[model samples]
Target: MDHKQIPTEIDREVRIPFQGFYNTAHDNVFDMALEQINTDDSNDTVEVISMDNVEWTAVRLGYAQKYLAEIDKTLALNARFSRIIGQKDYAIGNDILLARVDCSKLVELHDAINADPARKAAWAYYVKEALTERPGFIPYFSAEVEDWGAFGTWDDAQIDCMLAFRGIELEIDETEIAMELMEYVDEKIWSSVIDPDQVPGHVNNKTETQLST
Candidate 1:
């Protein structure tokens, strides 16, 4: 994939459905770590156009903001203090894996759907099964919003399962670029699943160079 595809801004006009948040590395050190993290050294074919900016049905938005500057600020802080942590099980709450993404665009989209009589009526009729079957449909993000409380109608552990299931989407203008950015982040974190050493750790408060090597 062309790393250059990732852009630095968001088109606020577009609204997207998002899943959760992910903490990703953005600097040269992180990039080098990612390269080393690839145990197979495989040249995988990364799809260019992603509707949700992720390859997974359940994408991890991972604390991503509408603006790249905000993301960079957080990454900088994390790197400065070497604050990255790890978990044995992808636990929810407090654990980075369980984090939720808050985007006004998604809130606005849901609101628009609620306000339109036809649109509001359509979700129940056509989207019931689809919504329930959404790769990880526990409604984690939806539950946080007051207006999205309608999803609470199906109250159950299914929501919890969805949270565990790591599938989510984020919609925005320049969606393809956004998707590329997400893919870039996932490459580093997901590698940890294969090789636990890739998970960022606070080893003696080590710097990025030490972590990458």
Candidate 2:
């Protein structure tokens, strides 16, 4: 059994509560690799122009996300298991199920839309058709904006530390197994991708992993 074990070195993680995390993200304290532009800098400076670029990229990403969510893409993805924690007054056995799908396709589409100057008007037209009435533009845009600044400011160590945020009941870090799989995937496929969203579901009442009933 040990030889066949999954070998996830998960016990080393800190279980920060899930509380205050969203607020932290908003406060510029979740430590995401987001831009820290000084508005004091002239409005038309290159930095501000770059900021505009990031925002526009993020806006298009929102359209892609809206289009994809309607597809329920998880039908072609991976799954993870968990139990409820940091919840108040829960039942004795509160297990939760989660799944995620690779958004590589939409991510590539977003990039292509953002890159081609000729497509700029086309994507703007698409966004007006699909994403304006939706609720995800800001969050979606913020993520892209953060990723842009992250490329310049965030290092591997900082990213590793980012994996250690509060309200973080569980940590899923890379292991030998994940690395091998990722290497295989990269070798087999060359594509850009989007981050997955957690799809929570109720399971057969398996709460053994919970810290308490």
lDDT winner: 1
Clashing pairs in 2: 17-167, 18-167
**Residue 93 C-alpha lDDT in model 1:** 23
lDDT of 2 by residue, 101-165 (tens): 22332233334545777664554443344334456443222222223342223332322222232
Stretch of 10 with least lDDT, candidate 2: 190-199
lDDT string, candidate 1, 1-213, tens digits = 133322223221211122223232322323433344443436653322222222221122222332232332332211112112233344552222222223233334445555777755654443344344466556443322233344323233333322222122121323343444655454424422432343344222111221110
Alpha-carbon local distance difference test for all models:
0.32, 0.27
Model 1 RMSD in angstroms = 15.4
- Tell me how far the alpha carbon of residue 64 in candidate 2 is from the true structure, in angstroms, after superposition: 28
TM-score, prediction 1: 0.26
